[model samples]
Target: MSQIDVATKSPIRQRTQGLRSRIEAFVRTFEWTWTSAVLFSMALLFFLLISAVVMPSFWMYYAEQKIGWAGPTDLQAFLEKPFGTSITNPLSLEGYKQVRDAIAMGLTTG
Candidate 1:
């Protein structure tokens, strides 16, 4: 019984030592590389998300400052020009129906 216990203990110790060495080698070779890659990707995504939120607001404020007190009128003109030709005429129900049909077609196809 003692001989069997001694024999089993030696093999178990050897197996544990082999596992530890393999794990250490793997850590030494690839641990920091994978960790840094993941961290950098996360930071890049965070930067893009923050910029998406901030950049448009910054542009809007800059545009308003550039336009000064007449900004609202300028915005109305800018919005109106596109709708006049592209979407619908501001004065007509037929134009509104055309715009609605265009939007529905676009949604269904896209």
Candidate 2:
């Protein structure tokens, strides 16, 4: 196998650079009007709203399923305790809160 030096660019690198340049040019030439700005904000907000609702619901459902227990039979119950099912799953809000609390406790106690 040959070594790739800084001066020598691979075909993949060249293609990636070309794509990046095209994207940059498009962004530079984009017309940012008030309507466009509002539309963009609305689209972003819509995406956030969808994700905020959907992702948590899925997470809670999956976590409950994985734990082999009947947790949060309804959406409202799940929303009320979003991280309740995450006691065993460390990738959820409860995990984050526990970690934050532990760090704070350590800092204050020391």
* TM-score top scorer: 2
Over 4 Å off, model 1: 1-32, 69-110
In candidate 1, position 88 carries an lDDT of 38
Candidate 2 has its poorest 10 consecutive residues by lDDT at 67-76
Per-residue CA lDDT of model 2 for 59-105, tens digit only, reads 44554566444332344544555564445663344444444444434
lDDT against true structure, model 2: 0.60
Model 1, residue pairs in steric clash = none
Off by over 4 Å in 2: 1-7, 65-67, 72-110
- Candidates' TM-scores? 0.32, 0.49
- The local distance difference test score of each candidate is 0.55, 0.60
Name the lDDT value of residue 56 in candidate 2: 57
